[model samples]
Target: MENSFLNRIKGKEFIFSTLLVAFVTVIGSFFRGIIDASNFAVLFLLAVVLSALWWGMASSVFTAFFGVLAFDFFLVPPYNSFSVSDLKYIYTFVGFIITGVIVSMVASRARRQAIETKQREARTAVLYRFSNEMAECETTPQVIGAVRKNVGELLGCSTAVFMPHKDGISDAGSDADFPLDTHEYAVAQWAFSNKKPAGSGTTTLSAAKAFYVPLETSLEAVGVLGIRTADGRVIFNTSEMELVTALANQSSVAIQRAVLTEKSREMELAKKTQALQAALLNSISHDLRTPLVSITGALSALSQDFEAVDAADRKELLQTAYDDSLHLNEIVGNILDMTRVESGNLKLNVRPCDLRDLIGASLTQLKDKLEGRMVAVDIPGDLLEVPVDFSLMMRVFINLIDNAAKYSPAGSEIYIGAKTEGNMAVMTVKDSGFGIPSGDLEHIFDKFFRAVKPRQVSGTGLGLSICRGIVEAHGGKIWARNNTESGAVFFIRLPLGDAGHGGRD
Candidate 1:
């Protein structure tokens, strides 16, 4: 009842407490035959204690002062008269009031301490929870998400997190929809750059809607955290400020960890790319030089020994030069096609195209190469039509079939077949040669990944890679695997039913 009364009192609950003390004294006086009037000081002391606990020193002072008047008028010296015969009663009355004041002071001090301690404990709990969440985060986005969630729960406000990027500060968690106008962003940027707090309550650009704190670590500031309302005003208490600063410190470490991890990955990738580029350059140089040297030798034989050489020898030299030139042209064409695929410039013209036509065209182009090899075709009649780029798809099949023929022995059987599986048209090419290494299966489609091991192959290593690129561009997948008995099998799967709109993008 006292606690509820205190809540409803606002500022004047102490009056009722003092009045109760007076009323209790009067009741004690009514029972003066059984109780001593001097004992009513205990009632005055109770009122003072109640006032101090609920209303602090202000109400306690009023209760102490008024309590003495009630005691002196009703219970002191000459009983119901405003006259004192004994002057010593003044000293006694003064002592009683002083005692009440002392008790009031002590109780008020304890009450204030209790309130402050409870508030501090609440803030500490919030801080601990926020830190725990940030510690559990394994990535930058997770850290940002933790901050938004924890801060909103603690302060009951909207939150935003911005990380420094090459373009500028951008939303990290993507839930930061607070009032961050140009001025606010500038303030946040300043806070991030200076590794300090700004906006709302700070000395720097106080007009900003959000309060920004830099997520700083020992190394540097990696990001900025901000809290604000839609209308751009939130006043934080001292404890809140401390909690946010601690959270910022914890968040900085998490973000730093994420950033360093990403940087390490990028550096590793760059190193791999550098190594790949160097290998590609060396292989391309050797291939180009070998063909040029062969063509030059044949031309020299034709020009210098024209009168001495026979017609048959001259014809052989001419054919050799012409074949090398064609090989060079094919290498250049594969490189160009790979560039187009990598740059996303290969636009496809999608329509109902016959797959058999593509297989026929590719076989016609490589008829001389597959002169002695047995070619088997097993395409289902129902799988005749598919959406594809006619020329690009022809290149895809040509590369796979030619790749199979080049690797296998003379007169080796090459199987080419297609069938419908689910909503996709699946094609396969099997070569009866030595199967690929298990370790190299995954890298078979990478550029410059040559399959020949002990023997020297006569073509660039980009043919398979280019084939993969073209098939992927047409919204298909191409993969190679070792066959069960011997050689390797390549599968190409393309979605049917107007799938991918013929790779328009």
Candidate 2:
């Protein structure tokens, strides 16, 4: 309420002091003889000072003019006109004008400094309010909404938040009337990925209408913040940018905290599950191993007497024992791998390997699942080598390919391609199969994320997630996207080993 009142006063044409100066000048002219001449000059100087302090240089000059005119007409020898009989009166008028001008000039300078000081204080107050609000925000959506509303009100602009995605940045809190354009999305993504500012008022892409700032934390960038003024002039100055950076930093910290809390909860749950798994393993190991040992002893006795018994019965017994052994091995391997991955104890032996050879090995391992599918290999012979844990990367590819084969029709085409783009080696595995549902796209790489819509498929739902873990540990990224034509495509990008320290091979 106090702010509103001050704003109203600031918007006025003249301040109270300016009006007071005019009032005193008029009354002083009327009561000329009663007022002492020398003292009246001091009063005129005070009026000029007040006018300048409240209403600026123009008001102070007008006050000085009126003071000189009043002194000459009412206080000189002539009572109602500008005629001055006494020559000493000339010095009085000259001295009065000089004093008023000097006082007004000084007052104007002081007023300007005071106004600037007040504006700085107001800006700081706004920043404080913004920081406090951002600290309370938990999720990305909440932060985006709060920031948009607050920034729009504070800076008087239409605000937006754009989050970086595979293709571009999607609007976080945008209305239909102000939808983000493609160019804006690209600029926003660039800013977000690089943790730099772009668009209006920045060195890069300053011709763009909107300003893009990266919502960067100490670790990494969360997203991009966009703000556009109604008048289209960039409203963000150096101080404003600093304030925005501070706000973004606070928001980043809050988001990081929320994510960490969620992960901690998940870890606790996993620990509990691990205890249950250990008990189950203990029970299964004892129960199943005893039966398997008895069956193997019976098979050995039967094999020794095979020549005297029926050949068909002996063959069925041997095949049954072998299949059970293979099934038991697979279950044990899966359990061990899960435990290693969950405990973060799966160390990778990183090395430079031919992507073509890696892809071929992965495909060979899953050849049974591929069945009648046409596996088209598009990797060039001269493709650059990638730095990776060869065995881990093979497992990642095999899992992705196996997943595609399971969801796709027998006769569908599966394309595996690799190439070098920028400083990364890009690989894509695509299948002409059922595309991922829109709702499941975001969680495709989450542990135990299965498509509920297609419940008929049998899976443990940990393939993609495990693949993501393996790729990320090797300083690479893995993500899934729906193909434009049909089916789903999983993309992997590894920094080229030959590039530089931060780049993957």
How does each model score on TM-score?
0.76, 0.46
* Per-prediction backbone clash count: 0, 6
lDDT of 1 by residue, 1-505 (tens): 2243345575565656666667767776876646655677777778788878977776877887787777777777567776766776576667777887888889989998897798778877777777777778877787788878877767677888889889578767634467757887888899888888999888888888788888888887888988885455455656667777777787788788878877898899999989988987898888888888889999998899698999999999999999999888988888788788777888888776777778989999999999988999987654367888899888899999988987887898999998877888899999998878999999889888876564646777788888888888878899989888899999999877764223333
Off by over 4 Å in 2: 1-21, 36-38, 56-58, 65-94, 105-125, 138-142, 164-172, 175-179, 186-207, 214-223, 230-505
Best by TM-score: 1
Q: Name model 1 segments beyond 4 Å from true.
A: 1-146, 163-176, 193-195, 230-233, 452-456, 497-505
Clashes of 2: 6
TM-score of 2: 0.46
- Candidate 2 C-alpha lDDT tens digits along 362-457: 988887768788999997657458888888899789888877887877788999998888888889999888889988989988765676446445
How accurate locally is residue 113 in candidate 2, as Cα lDDT from 0 to 100? 79
